[model samples]
Target: MAIDLRDPDESYVSFWRERHMCTLTTIRPDGTPHVVAVGVTFDPEGGPKGIARVITNKHSRKVANVLAAGPEGARVAVCQVDAGRWATLEGRAVIRTEPEAVADAVARYADRYGRTPTPNPDRVVIEITLTRAMGRA
Candidate 1:
């Protein structure tokens, strides 16, 4: 019931643009999935080969989940849904603690979510290399 975004129609793009929030899902060590509602930004050129980034802190459960799964683990997916459209981005995440990566994530966060991120080593950026994305118009 999902259509891949490689060929998204106008309605699908419109739906995506209209929504400001989406749920991000990650895998726990027990092989269960965890979902969290988050403010998201659309990367006109992100995901898979484009390097999708999500801003989060080390204290967040999602961060813990991804770190436990390891960088190459295939146990992550990010989903965004509105009334008439939905998209699921499948991928693996790399935990980022480096300052440069954090800076990039902070810039993205402030630009999209309008929140400033104070420098903290405990904060992390989950960079997801999307394998595929499915959306329905």
Candidate 2:
């Protein structure tokens, strides 16, 4: 069944937000998909439409892949799964180092993971503006 992504409820948002780990996939310039285990931060507002934040070392392969993909970066897909449940979110990765963006990312990380992300000059924040969601049981 196909469902409209615009209608994600708070429950759905909270479900994903509470998940401890998620996989983030990005496309390399050559078209190979690189997926990595990552800690994720769901937007405080919560919902299908809110953006998700992820932090990474600026020199990491994921960041390298994003940079190699150019300013628009590659399409990003994030997934959270448990024994009998799963949720995936898809969106374009927005790479930036702006102060506001940095602060937002830091805040999300601290709130969700309870660990402050150390600032790495090489760190780049990826904001996944969710465009879709799907679940399986």
Q: How many clashes in each structure?
A: 1, 1
Residue 74's lDDT in candidate 1: 46
Error of 1 at 42 (Å): 4.0
lDDT tens digits, residue span 1-137, model 1? 55454554567555544535778888888888898887544454664234557777789989888778755654677777666667776677878788997887778767766668676767778877766667774
User: lDDT by residue for model 2 over 1-137, one digit each (tens)?
Assistant: 22246666666667766746889999887899999999887663444566777888777888878778777656889888887777787877777778787877887788777878777777678887777767652
Q: What are the lDDT scores of the predictions, listed in order?
A: 0.70, 0.75
Candidate 2, residue 123: the lDDT equals 69
TM-score of each model, paired residue for residue:
0.76, 0.85
User: Given candidate 2, what's the lDDT at residue 111?
Assistant: 79
Which parts of model 1 have CA positions greater than 4 angstroms off? 1-19, 44-48
- Candidate 2 — what's its lDDT? 0.75
Instruction: List candidate 2 segments past 4 Å from native.
Output: 1-3, 44-48
